[model samples]
Target: MAKQLLAVAEQKARQMGLACDIAIVDAGANLVAFHRMDHARIAGIEIAKGKAWTSVAMQMPTANLAQSALPGGPTYGINTTNQGRLTVLGGGIPLVRDGMIVGGIGVSGGTSAQDIEVATAAVQAFAAAHTHHSTGASRTIR
Candidate 1:
């Protein structure tokens, strides 16, 4: 499943002509698969992984991290105290199956919205493929 997701992410990045750093992490926040496009910012590699790690670790999207850590929120200083390992920006999403989180995906090197768009497309592609295979339904990817 992780491999399939990574393939979809890579294909989407190529299709969008966006150089990106994509990271997939298992439910335990461990790295599963990663691809860093040529010319992507070298510094974004670990940031991307940390975003994915936070998603898998918290079983929620990374965007929520920012909101949850607002000035008076319970998670204030989380991103700061974590030493650059946490980001409140978009690009990380949890992979869910049967109501259980299986892994997560994080994309970097683009705008926050662009990163989310690419990651969302990859997730949608994976879900569509999985649904077809599980239900014996056929569809063309063209």
Candidate 2:
């Protein structure tokens, strides 16, 4: 699963002509697979991982997190409280299968929306692959 996610992400990154740092994290927010494009910023790797970890750990889109972490939101302190492991910015998305979150994908070193687009593409690719191999049916992962 980790390899599949990484492959799809890497492919998308290449196709989009964007250098990126991609990370895949398990449900526990542990790193499973990671890749840094040849020209990507070294720092983006960790940031991407942290964003993905935040998504899986919080079970919400990173964009939503960004909103919640605004100046006066309930989770404003989250940015400083999670040991810098949580990022409220965009680029992270949880991967769900069979109504269960399997892991997450994060992309960094690009615009926020670009990061989200790549990560979302990876998730969609994974879903399509899984569906193609299972009972000739398809399922949507929320």
- Over 1-142, each residue of candidate 2 has an lDDT whose tens digit, in order, gives 6877777888888888989999999888889999998999898988899889988988977988887789899788788867877888899999887888888888997888989988998889877777775755644332
Worst 10 residues of 2 by lDDT: 133-142
- In TM-score terms, candidate 1 sits at 0.83
Q: What is candidate 2's CA lDDT for residue 125?
A: 85
> TM-scores for all candidates?
0.83, 0.89
Clashing pairs in 2: none
* Candidate 2 stretches greater than 4 Å from native: 136-142
- Model 1, 29-60: lDDT tens digits are 88989888888888778867877888887778
In order, the Cα lDDT scores of the candidates are: 0.79, 0.85
Model 1: CA > 4 A from native = 81-84, 136-142
Model 1 clash tally?
0
